[model samples]
Target: MSVQEHRRLRELASMHFQSRCLHEACERGLFSELERSPGSAEELARRLHLHPQACRMLLDALTALALLQEREGLYSNAPIASRYLIEGTATDQGEMIAMYRRSMERWEKLAEALHCGHTPAPPSEPDPRFIHAMHCTASVHAPLVVEAVPRNNARRLLDLGGGPGTYSIRFLLTWPEAEARMLDLEPVVSIAQEYAEIAGVNERFEAVAGDYLESELGDGYDLVLLSNILHCNAPEGCQRLLKRAFACLRPGGRVVIHEFLRDGSLWPAVFALHMLLSTPGGDTYSESTLKGWLHEAGFGEPVVSRLEGTPSSVLVAARS
Candidate 1:
């Protein structure tokens, strides 16, 4: 192989080594401990009940990855790691990392899924860790999505597939008079309720538990949000859901869809692979394709807006 091609192949081959190193570090609470206080590998190993050599190697790998900093023999979390990876922080992403770690097993079977032409079935009971991970993610994205949505006289909202109802809570916060109904899987609804209560909007928010495709989403909503929901469904399923959203809205009401558009971004493209491994037909869709689906679902002309501070964008369509 050419030198350049050989180097690229080597990089790809060793990608999993870094992934495992980070995953193992997060799994072992290394970041959290380091956030509390810097320590030598020996001390950390004693505290965490790990071998000193293994702990040192892991800490050195994290330092190389820029997630941690080592001074002499003491290690501490880097600023980025302290902000996001450390548990109990306001912006903690530890749950999301754990969720990714949990999914690694399913992702390992990608070749088998390709050969069998089907992804594995979802667990009957939803994993609470996954729900918490989604909650953490939604908390970060809710403000961007709320900002992208057009402010109007929207008093009622239906948050379809709302994981922890973060978007709904944000919207309610933006419009004090607004009330929201969040529809999602049964297990997720409880999480949503907890978040809504924490946000002090539980009285204004209602949690409805059931599959959006099979559930009865009540009618006459001024707005409907399909945030990050389409990527979990096939194109046809997304179209059907849009139609349902259309039927649920009041006349001239709007439906807002938040998703990672296939707009030549590396993140969305890589996220598409995550969908391939996790869902049967779920994948990121192009903006033009989603617009076409919205049109076919009887919505009027759609306006697309890129969200600030995220790789996602929103498409707004009105029921005419």
Candidate 2:
């Protein structure tokens, strides 16, 4: 390899070292402790019950990564960390990091999965942290999607696979007359209930606990949202879901599919790899493929648009 190529390859190969440091810090509540108050290495170690030497090393590494700031032997959360990494904040991503940590073990077996043609066995019960992580992610991007949706006299919505019902709550808040039914797994639906109650939309929001792939979806909905759901299945599964959504919506009602499009974006490519590692046949889809699926599912020509301020794009089609 050329000199520059060798250097680039080395940096890429060692990227996991940096990720491990960040994930470990988040797992250990380092950011939360710093958010409460700045402290020296020994002080933080004592508070979080870590060995002094290891804690000091982690603190220094976090500082180097710009997630923390250090001054005069004291460490504190950086502005970004304070806003998004500290637990209990409005935009806290602690749960998301925790979910990543939980997935790390499965991700480490990617090579084995490729050889065996399947992922490892799933846990018996759903992990609550994963649901919270989806909530955190949806809370940040739901508003962007809501703006893109057209809600003219739309009174009912079906949030298919709505993990935490963040989008449904936002939709309800945007259109006061609208009511929503969130369909998801039982464990995830329970979390959605809490979120709806907290948003004060429980009176208008209902949770349906079942698999979207196998459950019966009620009819006569003005809007059906398939946000972030398609990438969880293969193409045939996506077609089945689109057909189901088509069957459930009222005539002239719109079905919105929110997903990361394969349009040469770096993030989508990286997320596709993540799906490969974690799911049986999930991967990001192209816009042409989604449009074709919608057409096959009995929807009219779909309009594809990118959501502002988010990585996702939307395809809105109306049932004839």
RMSD of 1: 1.8
Computed on alpha carbons, the lDDT of every model, listed in order, comes to 0.89, 0.89
Give the per-residue lDDT digits (tens) of candidate 2, residues 148-236.
88887999999998988999999999999999999988788888999999999999999988888889998999999999999988898
Q: What is candidate 2's TM-score against the reference?
A: 0.94
- Compared with the true structure, model 1 gives a TM-score of 0.94
**RMSD list, candidates in order:** 1.8, 1.8
Q: Cα deviation of 302 in candidate 2 (Å)?
A: 1.8
Per-residue lDDT of model 1, residues 121-232, tens digit only:
7666767788788878888888888888778889999999888788999999888999999998788888889989989999999999888887888899999999988998
Clashing pairs in 2: none
User: Deviation in angstroms for 51 in model 2?
Assistant: 2.4
